[model samples]
Target: MSDTNVNPQITDAVTQANVKVVGDAPAIAMGNLYQAAAKSTGILFQNATGTQQQGALAEASTNQGVMQIYAMDTAADAATQVKVAETGVADNLTGLLTVLESFKDKGNP
Candidate 1:
């Protein structure tokens, strides 16, 4: 038999301290959530940050903009695909309406 008196307040304080330690770095929680979601959905992502370069290449690269390149490239590619799809949709709808009108005229006669 033990005669140790346990303090509820002390135990609660210890538990809170452990939680605080675990919560100190938000990256730990974020990374765990990301991993869990990826496992459930079978998707993976990586952050792509690189070290700063020094020289003419870095200066030349800095003079231009990556955002502009990505935006223009994506817009150009998507616009061509959308334009072709829209033309096909328009032709299909016109043909269907013509067929429906002929059916209506035949039924009314």
Candidate 2:
């Protein structure tokens, strides 16, 4: 007979999932939403800065259309600068990067 070992967590997860509807995380839906919003806002703003920069770069040589874009660009730039200067954000980002680098996909065959 051919030998193959199924991953234990996959089996356990299936069993537990079938037995239980959901976990504590799912039971508190609004709390999860607030948590997600709090956690993701920073990441989203980081990305949004890049997107806004690209958009501004695209419209660099344009005529004065609306002041809204200019105000947004200025605010975003100031916020990022403040975030960089405020606390241990650099160290936190470095730690996150290191953790990501350390993740080796052993499951990939």
Candidate 3:
């Protein structure tokens, strides 16, 4: 207790203000912690969404590549059919046997 001449009312008001600040400290800290947690949760969801989208895009691209390969195979078969039709001879083991038979008949005649 100092022997100063400060008013009792003023001292009481200052003491109440300090107590109020101290009382609010825990609530302020908890609010900040909740805010940080919410932000971290939001970031985690955003990253998950991004990875899912990338995986979907990769799947789509792979499917397109497979479709292109199938299309190329069909196109090659069509070209071979056209060539076989124009030449009137198949290019297989049966075709080779037919040609050999024809040569054998010609040689015998």
- Predicted structure with the largest lDDT when compared to the true one: 3
Instruction: Give the alpha carbon lDDT tens digit for every residue of 1-109 in model 1.
Output: 9999879999999999999888876978888999899886653222212223345568778667775676577777899999897789779899999988998899764
| Pairs that clash in candidate 1 | none
lDDT per residue as tens, model 3, 1-109: 7778989999999999999999999999999999999999999999999999999999999999999887787877899999888776455767899888998899764
The local distance difference test score of each candidate is 0.77, 0.79, 0.92
- Alpha carbon RMSD to native, model 1: 17.3
- Which stretches of model 2 miss by more than 4 angstroms? 1-35, 61-109
Candidate 2 lDDT, tens digit per residue, 1-109? 8898989999999989876765654768878898899889989999999999988977874635555556567877889989877767788899887877667444423
All candidates: TM-score? 0.23, 0.23, 0.63
Scored by Cα lDDT, where does model 2 land?
0.79
Better of 1 and 3 by lDDT: 3
By lDDT, the better pick of 2 and 3 is: 3
Clashing pairs in 3: none
lDDT (Cα, 0-100) at 1 in candidate 2: 85
Residue 44's lDDT in candidate 3 = 100
Question: Against the correct fold, how does model 1 do in TM-score?
Answer: 0.23
